[model samples]
Target: MKKLKLIAVLVLFPLGLNLVGVWELQRSTDDHAEYAAYQADLAEFRPELQAIADNSGSRPVMVDVGDGEKMEVKMALSRVTEMQDELDTLLPLTNVMAWVAKGTITLGLLAALVGGLGLLALNWAGRRAMHSRDQLLHSFTRVTKLLPYVLVGHVVVMGAAIAAIVAFEALGAWHAGRLSAGEMKFMFFGMVLVAGCLYSIWQMGTQLRVMLNMFQPTPMDVMGEAVTVEQAPVLWAYVKDLALTLGALPPDHIVLGMAAGFYVTSGDIALAPANTTLTGRTLHVPLAYLGILDEAETTAVIGHELGHFAGADTEFSMRFVPIYHGIERSLVVIGQTLVDSEWLQRATLHPAFMLGAYFMESFDHAVMHWSRVRELEADAAGAQLAGNLAAASALVRISAIDPMLQERLVAHITQATRPTSEHVPVSDLPTTVLREIAALPLTLPEEEMATQLPHPSDTHPSNGERVASLKVSIDDAVRSGTRPLDATQACAAMDRYFAQPDVLRARLTDDYLSHHVQQDAVLVETLRTHAGNVTGDVALHEGARLRGQILIGFSGLLAVAGLILLLAPVLFPGAAGRDPQPFFVGAGIALFIMLCMLPFGVRLFRRAHKTALLLTPDHFVFANLKAPLPIRDIADFNLQVGNVVMLTILLEDNAPLPELTSRSFFAPDVALNKKKRWLMLPMSKFCRDDKKLKLPELAELIGNYVNAGAARHLLQQRSEQSGELKAG
Candidate 1:
């Protein structure tokens, strides 16, 4: 399906280019036909005029006026020769038009040919990558290398086609201008095409920059503390022995952290604690996981990580990871580019974006399959180190418990961040939390565990598939209860591995608490700001002010131009050559434009001067409306966040809303919709200083006010009912 879409885009772009050529040709053909008819009519009278002139020297010829009336017209033989010469010169213009049309059409055909051949080459490479399973690494490497060139080729071809079309169209327009005195109109269109071409170039440059940034060596965020060999000699020894047993290269750096899973990487890592970067191969041990898995299962997990370092997989990864990241980043940038572009720019850029996307998509598909295969091989290597049952058991335990553990951790953090929640003191907080999580019985159902697919990050296969490949039954591998290490054994292992386990755990806990404390502070601050906004005026975003200024300036320019156009021919009639029709037409257009634009500019200026949104105890007011909307009339308000943040206000049914025609710079973006009105402003745009504000925080604040209003209304109704009952 993806390939077909790609092909369709490729084919459609060239066809669209050809259509441009056809339109140009048709326009020129019409002009040529008109001229040809005029020239033929003139040719028929030439011989009679020549005969009259030769017989009578410089005689005035009698010509027919309208309705069979005769009129005398002066003529000379030299004047007749001059008129014929002018016609002779103009006749060759049609030939130039024909050549221009042919050239444009030829360019389109060439573009189509280039696009077709590029697709073929990519298809052929993809087939080789898919079928060459025996030489999988070689095949994947070849495809990876080929992909960049193919992508570049597609972009270049599309760019060249656009450039060519723009050139040919501009030439055609310039010629058309000679026939009709409308050069400015044609020039404006030409500028638009040129702008589109330039914007496409900018988009390509942005993608290239994103791709290039990937190659710059940057520290990978490990989000954990580093563990040196001196600090955890036993852990390091265990990893080295596991690597030796698997016949793989051992990691140079080790990190013990509270992340959900264990992993290994060849990239440089920046440890969360101590703010230090570690270079070369690194192995990360999730501290929480060690408490859950017994010694043998732990060994099996380590062995599996070592497997990635074995044979050709390590070499493949060294080459593949950078390309993978580059492609991912470029795709994200292009997608954002498309979103930010206007409709005309989108039309010009969509094809080029699609071609690049197709290449990335194809590469990802091939590499993902290869990754899955490599993971299976790693599982086999792990089984050799420990028994197949141990390997299978570790896989099942990790798959089932990791998700629940992550959820528990998030719940704990959420609890700690609440305003009213108090901190609990513990001697070793990290270890205590891990033990508690480990003691919780695994509730993951067998069916669900069997269905869990590989995470894209590591490409680890599902528990069911791994166990089946190892010839182990699901029942045998699944943990019956919390079969984790005893607390005493767990403490012993920690002591044996980490050098000062208690202090490290304490520091990690402090870091976690401190992070949550900052979050609580932010929440408090948002509440304070919301309280202020409820009582005070909320001003328009700076963008609104800028928009108002732009509108005013534009309107002023239009007015000046209109005045000039209207008075030009009137002030100097001789400039019009005694035919004032062109000047009249231009003045009429200018007058119409000024009439439309000036009023809109005034409205924007008035709105921009007023407050954008006014929040009060009882009512909400907008800049555009004279009357305020009572709080009771509003059902709800929400923040729709995307490329921009929009506050949508949903009104109660049949609520009285002011009728609006013109769009105000400071008013709601969509006021015509009866159900929902919105302020199309990003939160950041509201502040002069670049303060980062969250959507959910503002949403919550608004909800609080609305809910408070509802509570008051309910109490009032109850009081009224009580009074009525007493009276009865």
Candidate 2:
């Protein structure tokens, strides 16, 4: 449907140009008074020429003329005859040119009208089809399916129209005895237009075929290694049983990927109920996702993928995929063609191109909006299959885990590579890490969740929106009686039945490290040395101190200026009577603002002065801590790198601390509780320009004091890995 609309625009664009040409031609040819006056002059001279010719009497006769003594009558008659012939010949051609101009304008108007009506009808039909929902899948199927036909029709009609216009102009040039330079240019432009339209149509067809091929179900040949029933019988059994319970056909092939998601693929044609089977279906399950998800959650995730098939989403997508991709490819082709042509490049800044671009953008947005609706429908189906609560929980967990899992994997690899670790075999690493991550809270904050809202181009709704919709489904009586095996037991069963676990684990680890890790043996050694020398309080970096001083100076300057302003009226007594109130009011506001901000300014100054890493014999002090933290109580310390460096301290169990009030006078009423917490340190404030400390160095230093054996071993392993990398 969008393709047809674009084709209409293309046709109408040239039609408009041609109409303008015709109008200009008509204006130039409209005045025939000059030709009529020339005819009248010729008519007046003809009689005199006839009399002169008759009087010549077959000889060059001398005759008495008014202005001269003698003249040849034959020569005078010849001049009059030439003037009459020229007028007679030129006048008819002028009339013919005017008529042809009017005819071309008429043809252009007719084509525009027809094309506009066709496009309007197609758009109206599309809207009607979208609104009609009595037949579920059948409602919009016919309308959507008609889109390709309309596109083909549009191509044919527009191509023919362009060819006709070019032919008419060429024929007119031939009839006029020669083609003007401007006419030749117009013909060349017409040819280029035809060629571009043809190329775009061909490209759209190719893209559509490729997009449709994605829906053709087959075995998982190009995906990850296959997980047969023999290798994961229990896992397979749960998935198969869930499929049957949800009224969906079980997948014949299951493939495990390294990424964190699952999806289903099926053939384009829907099979009859009697012949329906899973022979042509493939289910792709990412091992990372499976490892982290509990049995129920896993069921929910798989159910969501299966829902694509059970909910007729696969069929709907087949129709929508072509339209969406066709618009995208067409835009690319048009944009590229315009850029490649100098004339077209200039034309892009014209209002026509801007309007066209806006139209295409609006079409894309509409298609994506429908795509998001399809996603929600599929989610609802999955809710029915796996129970709404489970489905909602699965989505939320996936949203959080998708980003966190990679970091966790990197941390685990760092820990497992340590020399002091009882090297758990690679086969055991995935399960161990999964269990550890599962134990941590996986809630995403509301602000972070808001970022997931669907953009104009996105096909999926936000996680929060999906969860809300699932909750509605749950409240509306969507539930399941069947419960899967316990999470721990299910994981154990999967591990026991799985084949080549070590190879898979190593593959995932290597893939991650290759992309993310950059080995630096020298940097590792430097960090190790820094860890050994951290025995005293470290001051803020010189850069941080300079920044702090600048801020303090600005604040002090403002304060001084406010005081001066407050005393300005008294000092300048000549102006006191006229504007004393205004001066006092303005000065008072400035002073009040400065005074209000004084506490914050004092806090910033204190942080600049007192912020440090205090490493004592028995404790580690960070940032603005009232006292040092006992080294023995620290469980782990990690670093997060961004605009500024942050060191997070995780305490063991639930350690207690003394009650404290806010350090800043502005917030004196705020209080702190005595409990183990994740404390963050702004390490950038304590860094120095001459000897800048990296996050890894800081983390290593703190880790050494917190867990000496683990820190030493981890650093040693890091050194070894770095050396190996450098050697290779």
Candidate 3:
């Protein structure tokens, strides 16, 4: 309890109390006049600027009158003041004198802080207990085998450091015959603490290194026989190519699973790394009951998995895997890297550090969800290398093939998300979700949402979006009459992403389903809620731009006020009581008013979300932004790529034009609402437009693209796999 109290004072209370104080302070000092001026100027319109907004998306507008009603400004100011207070309440105080006072309060607030810290630790341990992190642990343990070498290095370095420190201390005390006992005690204690920390780190590193497969060179194909396994002749051909790719991977290991097989640990390998192991791969094929995918499809799967291996993507992750694995293994086996990183050396150190480390580890788990998403990219790269036809089939087959594993995966997914709900009362969750949970769901947004950031903002494209991107890339290459480049080479090159093919099919059906085709109801609802917003925001943003013109016009009022102020001194010289302060104040107000008229800036988060949604209009006519994409711009296309389908509407008369992404593919009806605002389109309205594009016209357009030999070739293998009659 004392340790908990100390932690609360040092960490939790300071973050909380300081933020609350900041918010309260800001609340006390918000300015209202600025807001009213902003609003009133927005609603009022000018004829010259209004036309530009209507025709060109938005117009450069300015208000001629510097005089806005004072009452409106006052009310606006009042609201902003409250908002400021809310903001202040959330701040982590960095103001002068806060450090000492905050530090003092922190020492006392440790109990409250430690409570949440303890809660987080309990939740993390519970989660680890419940999940099959053992598979991951085993995988990491393989990495830990290398830890002994690392431990040796650390021990050598720290031993030398200790000896040097001791020697220096002895030299200083040589003249005194003997060191003061108290002074000697403090020095010994400090050195011992440092030594213990070094030992712990070395021990942990050694444990995790045991799990690492990369530290040792073990070929996946020990005998170097690529044709050892028997299969269909067509499948064999692609497998041969796959073997070559795998052979090139250092520490050569080749694994194949048509569905989900234990081949990773199966063929002459008792302890291959999880990366080399082939359990999950065969599960998809077998569980879905898919007849083996065709040559192209199979090739795609191999290429995709192979891409992950070749690129050393797994190595890229697990940078910290060894550290944690070492600690966990040591904790489980010997019970020592169990000491907290900061407090491990101090015999009297706070237990909260260990608890705090628990949350940090939990947070790492939360972020690891992105690794699954990253797998999707590997999937796409595999498709690209193996050929689109094979990849497309492979993806379709994957969803169908791995039922039990997918179910388990879905369960693990639920486990991962539980941390986000850590704060939710267990009583509130559905009985099923509650039962699966080990502890209360973590309610902290900062940790859960933190991982989501630096994702879309990063140069690495999202895994969810990669399939679409690859499709566009393929279409572009085909149109350009260039042979598709190698996936490895393509990664090293750059090009404007080409147009996407119109979707031929997108529906959900399974063992429990009654319908042949079903739209995602969630998507429909989402589209319904936000399609209106995308439109309204686009319109509102434009309106805001036009209204801001009025703000600029206030500058003219500033000029007039300045003129009035200067002229009043001479023109009203006889009026002894005339004050120039009023004119000058008016001019200042006009200048301030002008500044507010500029375009209302969109928040970065909102923009990022918009980018994620792919919401920017295909062609936008907004203030200072003009982008037009006509339906004639589409070329030979395919909208039937795995799990995605859409209508393609071209806007240009020219053949084989660069694509317009947002406009061409009509949102699949079911998904229209769920992702409507994200796509930033009134998709249904555009898709349903009778005058502009009736169903027959859309159909004819699709038929024309499908009929083209270039597009037809892509489906030659796909249509046959689906047993669907190929339309001429």
Q: Could you say which candidate leads in lDDT? A: 1
Q: TM-scores, in order shown? A: 0.63, 0.47, 0.24
RMSD of each: 13.8, 18.8, 30.0
Tens-digit lDDT string for candidate 3 (190-236) = 66765664576455454444323223322222111121223223333
Q: After superposition, how far is residue 335 of candidate 2 from its true place, in Å?
A: 5.0
TM-score computed on alpha carbons, candidate 1: 0.63
lDDT of each: 0.63, 0.54, 0.35
Best by TM-score: 1
Candidate 3 regions exceeding 4 Å error are 1-237, 243-292, 311-377, 389-393, 404-463, 472-728
Please state the error at residue 166 of candidate 3 in Å: 19
The true-versus-predicted C-alpha distance at residue 504 of model 2, in Å, is 4.1
Candidate number that wins on lDDT, 1 or 2: 1
By TM-score: ranked, best first: 1, 2, 3
The positional error of residue 458 in candidate 1, measured at the CA in angstroms, is 3.2
Report the poorest 10 consecutive residues by lDDT, candidate 3.
500-509
lDDT of 2: 0.54
TM-score of 3: 0.24
